[model samples]
Target chain A: MTTAEITVLNKSGIHARPAALIVQIAGKFSSDIHFARDEDRINAKSILGVIALGASHNTTLTIEADGPDEKEAVAALVEIFQSKFSS
Target chain B: MKVYSLLSLGEKHKENFSFKVLVHGENRNLSHATMNRPGLALTGNFQIFSNNRIQLFGKGETAFLYQEQHNPGLLVNCKKLMQEPVPCWIFTHGLFPPKAIIDLADEMKCPVFSSNLSTSLFAIRSNQILTDEFAPRGVVHGVLVDIFGVGILLTGKSGIGKSETALELIQRGHRLVADDAIEIKSIKGGNILLGAGIRKEVAHFMEIRGLGIINIPHLFGTGAVRESKVIQLIVYLEEWTDTTTFDRLGIERHYKQLLDVTVPFRKIPVRIGRNIAIIVEVAAMNARLDNMGYNATRDLDDTMKRYMEKNK
Candidate 1:
């Protein structure tokens, strides 16, 4: 498994749109990816799981990925989080 | 997918539903849940005639047939309907079968039945009876209770306190559906599970070890008991043991199969000082939340990983 810590730079944090974007990106890879904050963790590929995090701006989150393309999955997720989930 | 022959249906529900057979069609089968009124079909418009459904001839249909008696095409249309393997024809409101239709039915060997009930009432009652008759059914050893608008079935061994927990739950304002033997029926092709007591006389009664056969509705009033409910969750009580490991995270979803239908299942260990009733209540509420797409375990997992990342 590959893991990376990334902060949410988006002003709205992980709201509906950004969560949907994360799910979209995470679904592209063959790896199982999850986002963890505090004592909670959820599937990165699930929009509901991402929205349930309620991670506000600047809150650091851990992205974990495991499977055939774990490294690529973690890298792509970290990029999405650092880029404020894109415009 | 079993079909009930018209003769068997006539024998089974004759007394209760007041079904009077006008003509006997021995080989005809009644399989569908829906009944149709072939008003347009009688007018020689066979475009939307549902041949598989049981046809009903009410006041309006009978009047139309009587008004159209002079039309030669009317008998032809009636014959066409009877020849298409239709289950049976019923005349409601104590209406007698018309001469032409009865003659065609007799010749075609199609079943014809009449009832004293009004058109709307007979339609509604027949629909319910047919749906129940055709539902996939099986008996489950459990206590079904309605908690927080969710139907939960409590299952366990013979002496594992299933009824006791149900009694406690009822005391907490939940409604008991069935005790000991639950009759589970899968309606709509196994998409739903409807539960009821095995017998109407013993429906709301429960048997606790020390307390023999307590009447729930009598003790707690009618609000504490329900005739039937759609089972949404199944909680199995097990004796706590060191050897058997349980699911601590609640991420793995479990399901139990009843009458070819699958329902959400949970295993709660019965141990000292553990309030099983409260756990069951919480489980019921949690099931509602899960259905609404809010899973606490998954949310907590996300939060924990973030904390770990910052500390590392």
Candidate 2:
């Protein structure tokens, strides 16, 4: 299992489109990924779960992945958050 | 699920609903959930004709057919329509099927039925019946109630106060859908789950342990009962045990699977001095809020985290 903390930097924060992108990226990996904000944790691969987090700009989130490709999954998610989900 | 025959429809709704069989196509199947008014098809427009639907010929369509009886083209179009394997044809407002149409229906082995109901009334009643018949169904032992416009299925072991809670909810202005046995149907390709009583005679009747069977609609008026409701939540009641742990914070969500569809589920411990009906009401309202994108637990967590961060 691997975990990384990242701050949401996109001006619009994690809305529907960005959450959909996150779910898509999470689906590509074999790992079980989850996004945690404070006490609420949700399956990162589910678009509804990610959107329910309601993470806004500057909101810190802990991305946790568990599987053989956990490191790659966390790195990819952190990079997306750092890049403001442009790609 | 297999298609129902026209004879089955006549027999099933024999008591209240009436249908006069104009042509004997008893072997034809009615499979689809929707019925169609073949307005354009009667006028020789076969491009958008849906053959599988039960075609309804209302006053307008029947009038058109009557006016165009002598037109040879009309006979050809009617023949062409019956050529397709339609479920059946129904005439509303006591209108008789024209001889030409009836002849084509008999030749093509398509059944035709007539009803005394107005076009609008027949359409509404048939739609409701067909929707129920075609829905994917499963039976569950529970009490279904409508609280705050949300359907909550109270499921637990027998004698766990399921009906008692439902009765209280009914008394509190909520509506009772079903008790003891609930027939849940998944409509619109498993997108929605609707709950109804297993038997028509027992609908809206709850059997309390000491009070026996009580008709909720009769006791509390018609507003206390609902014919059917789309199930939105499942509340499983369990006796509070010393070792059993309950969900104190509503952060994580649970689901109960029924007929291949997953509905939101919650577990509430049944304990003395605890008002289960009020808790179920709040649960239903909270579920509505969750659907509207406002989660109280998550909001409280964020507030507490922000407060701690500022203090640190």
Candidate 3:
């Protein structure tokens, strides 16, 4: 499993649009995508699971993916986070 | 959306979005303290000070006064200035701040500063610098489409047809907010989520299977889309794998992080003849229902519990 950490820069944190985007990207791979914040752990491809975490701006979150494309997924998602979801 | 209103305002002002502030520039002697504070003011204009080293921030219009120089008369005037007190200060580096301005800033109870570059360079560079520091520019691959008044974000593999599905949703009377990469911003209170696609020159338009790159705004008209929307739902598109288990019931909610907020989510598997667009739209409606306190999964669970009790 490849793990990555991101700092939330969105004013509302990790709300709907962004969570959905993450799930969408995670779904592209053959890997098992998981994200955790605080004490919550969830499938990164599941919108409901991600939203339940209630992550907000500047919140540090962790993501893990395990599979053939685990490395790629981790790298891309980390890049996305570093891009503040904009790029 | 509500989430977007919280983020610091973008420089290219949009009429739909507005901000106000009282701006007063002062030349002053550089102070070590006024190096890099940035935030908002009481009336709304973002404040910055350039003593030629660092930039500071004041978050909002109602923020407090921050300064660099230590001048007593100005300090007294600022303390007695009346009205609302401003918060935050941006100090420029390299440029020498005039003493009078420094005193005025101190008296006005405003934050002061220096810039790392010369005045003209600071003016040009400050915008970029501040934007880099304060703008919420997080982006993600998403298809933003409106369904029944709710903005839905569809995400998944490259071939999962997130864009195609969004196109269909638009044809079905839903509006498109963005395609491919969606830029999102979180506004104050961390609730409103605003999103928009990159400019047309950089939009990539979108080419789907069986269809070439189509100009969505051209075909659908401007009404078919919004410049941005609050992201409320996340629908993940996945290709079915024999080893993977999919959700049989629409109960379990999934989530992903962007900056800090958590949004409700659903996982929709992509398969032949699934009418992915319809499913996505339904998911959006269902999410809206959940927001309205009507949860299908919870209701079913309650019903099942009742049935067991009755049978027992």
Candidate 4:
């Protein structure tokens, strides 16, 4: 398992478009990735699951992935969060 | 629990205990899960009183408060009780607190509620709601379906056909409780595992591989869906392997624990030609039969033993 944390820096937070970007990035790897906010743990590959996190601006989210490419998957997700889903 | 949310649960059923909010607090939380009568505490005996609990003023307490209305101090005990951080005050039997008391409660920023149910009845119903609200809950990646009135949870790796099997069951007149991610709560003191969808807005909706999001109720009507159900059985759908071992007989029961509740469990191998829907249905029926004290495998073993003894 690999884990990393990132705060929602964008003023818009993880709305529909950002959630879609997360899901898209998460789908690139075979690892089982999930993002947890508070007590809620949502599958990152599912758009609805990402939206269900209900994360708003400044909410810190922990990304966890478990598989052969766990470390790479976690790094990929952190880069996306740090980029604020811009690219 | 949010006191506002608690109000919604208490007044959900009009017949059980119809509650009316006399004063709404600042969306405060109910600090405690239990209720208190405030019987002795009304007389200034503050000795073992739980100020965090919601105080219920029953007939006796109401009458006592009314009689104290004539006192020169103007019911100081009520004022004293309200001064504490009591989450709220509930008056039963359609009784209303004196205007003085209500004003005092309003000044203290304590919520006040009234219900038409008798004291004991309201207490019982609210306690039941509180117990459920405070129960432990968890979220599982699975699809819960009701077949033959049995709640069967299908769980496995993503894209392993849990949703596909559930769709087939729904086609066969079974009900879909939740799909993808099922939110489960254990109630009845951890004896019952109640399952529901993550949210009501997204319930009865499924995400298919190629079809995207589809509404079951819209596709199959309201009869094909249910809000929630007790998870009676769990089935894990996995890829088939030549060397994998499977349970041939239902003699030994397998259990899967959810929120501290044990539910009958089974693992079914998935293959191209195999019909997982029918297998799940049969599993549910078998569970129902087991509940009726009948075990086909055990019965067969006993019959075989009897025949061998007679021949010997």
Among all candidates shown, the one with the greatest lDDT: 4
Q: Write the per-residue lDDT of candidate 2 for residues B1-312, one digit (tens) a residue.
A: 547776877679854447777888647777787888788887788887798888888888888888764676887877777764687778888898678778778888887788999888887877777776777776567789999999999988655788889888898999998776567889866788988876555666666666645778889999888888999999999999999999998898999889888999999999999999999999999999999999988999999999999999
For candidate 4, what is the DockQ-based docking class? acceptable
Q: Positional deviation of B226 in candidate 1, in angstroms? A: 0.5
Ranking by TM-score: 4, 1, 2, 3
Segments in model 2 whose C-alpha atoms lie over 4 Å from true places: A1-87, B7-27, B32-86, B89-102, B112-132
Ranking by lDDT: 4, 1, 2, 3
Worst 10 residues of 4 chain B by lDDT: B1-10
Model 1 per-residue lDDT at A12: 77
Could you tell me which 10 consecutive residues in candidate 1 chain B have the lowest summed lDDT? B205-214
Residue lDDT tens for model 2, A1-87: 899999999988888789878977998898878877764456686554565567889999999999999999999999888889988
Candidate lDDT values, in order: 0.83, 0.82, 0.60, 0.83
TM-score of each: 0.59, 0.58, 0.51, 0.89
Candidate 1, residue A32: Cα displacement in angstroms equals 44
Between candidates 1 and 3, the TM-score winner: 1
Q: How many clashes in each structure?
A: 20, 0, 107, 0
